[model samples]
Target: MTDMASAHLSHDPKWTRAHSIFSAPSEGADVALIGIPAHEVSLSATSAHQTPGAIRDALARYSTYSSAHDVDLRDFSLCDLGDVDSPDHESGEKKVATAVANVRANHKLLIALGGDNSITYSVAAGMWPDLSKIGLITLDAHHDLRDGVSNGSPVWRLIQAGLSGKNIVQIGISDFANSREYSQRAKDAGIHVVTRDVLRKRPMADVMAEALDIAGAGGREIYVDLDVDVCDRAVVPACPASVPGGISADELRQAAFLAGADARVRAIDITEIDATLDTPDQRTVRLAALLVLEGACGVASRKN
Candidate 1:
């Protein structure tokens, strides 16, 4: 075998590129991953704070190339900015916005690994100084319209922060995972609700096309948030609120890729998984890693 093929040897630790394989953070790269490793301030719990690092570890076990997309991750330029440090949720919000603002300023794609869904408001606030010019799309099991500063209320928080409800589109909303009051609030706010049942009734590509069209309306930049809880409980063992029936793992990856490939999508985030609660096989973390890769693949394809 040639050196290149031989180098694929199973025992070759040198060829193993962990998640850290990406180039180090720089002002030059057009795509970057930023970690927010604290959920205490957002969820009122600290369990998911370790997820960012765990995702990187799981990523090391996989190849960077995607035969399906015909794209090799190493061919793309991306940076890992490590993690943001904040003592409280209030500060965490500011920190996240600042990080996202930095990415926007550099004209780069921001892939944020979140402490929880709360990161959405902060990211949107940072990416669009004018909320009126922004569109929000969330693939989540819940409306996230709760009336508090916790993980369940980011959508409501963003609306209060000046985001137009008409520009928000929520997908993968599952049964029994939300309250009637919150559902009514979503409707009253004019938020477009695309339930898990709706997805079941249509092709994923068609649903995503419609989602992108709605989210990109008026030429506004889109911020897509992927709450891991949107996936089935079997696929997201680490997401405490995840239910039994939801989108499949492959479907979620496709959604992320579609969002990332859209020119209007300036930022994306994956949230709500608690690494400490993950299965022994680390299936959840591995899936999260693949989601990141799929997003990167979309970015790479766009550049090509």
Candidate 2:
């Protein structure tokens, strides 16, 4: 076993450690995982660059088997492509695009561990430079349409880069987290908005299906961004923008799994977590790791 595998050894052979399943880069992988630690231009102060590694490390705490889905991630071919060095600037985003473009062809799904929400632009850009052919779904607490190159502005940047706003859906948008200006921008751009209040009344599965249908309209490929800040602050202390009334952790997990289960959903990125800020119980990072597994389980369900 490799060092990572050894550290996560399980007592029972039937119960495999989750971290042990992802191996070195290989061909025909079902899932390809990569780290994009881009925190330089964040709107708020964050040590989010440490999140990818923390999520990876947190995987050691869980088993590959998912009781809910009756699936084992070990049965899938997973690879870790490591991290993109210094992905906090334009040149680095290009590196992210190039790296994603290189491996996306060989994998069924690419799960990009984010430094922040900024990776959404680069990853989606890499997946489909012709943004018109792809749709976007963001599970976030903010509009992410702020005017700048920071983590809060990727959606706007992507829209500027040719992505049609009509095909974009932003869910879990909190009341105080965004400005009326950006809300109007989203409205003007034809971006669909599903507020946090609405989610409180609707089932997560229903919301996910609707978002996927809207974003994946015209049979376009979809990219889902799982920004951790969409969860309640109590659930994700590491997410600076998370609020008291945001979605529950379970809802977020369900959303991720549903996104992964859809055939048209080509890629997903988990973002906005600052590992260093997590509570003593490490709940935030653990939840992020579980989101990865839930997504993998969703992918595994495709064979059923």
Per-model clash counts, in order, read 0, 0
lDDT of 2 by residue, 104-199 (tens): 578888899989999999889988879988899999999999888999999999999999999999999999988899999999999999999999
Instruction: Say what the RMSD of model 1 is.
Output: 4.3
Q: Score candidate 1 by TM-score against the native.
A: 0.92
Q: Estimate each model's TM-score.
A: 0.92, 0.96
**Can you tell me which runs of candidate 1 are displaced by over 4 Å?**
1-20, 42-46
- Candidate 2 local accuracy as lDDT? 0.90
Off by over 4 Å in 2: 1-10
- Top TM-score: which candidate number? 2
With candidate 1 superimposed using the best TM-score fit, by how many Å does residue 266's alpha carbon deviate from the native? 1.0
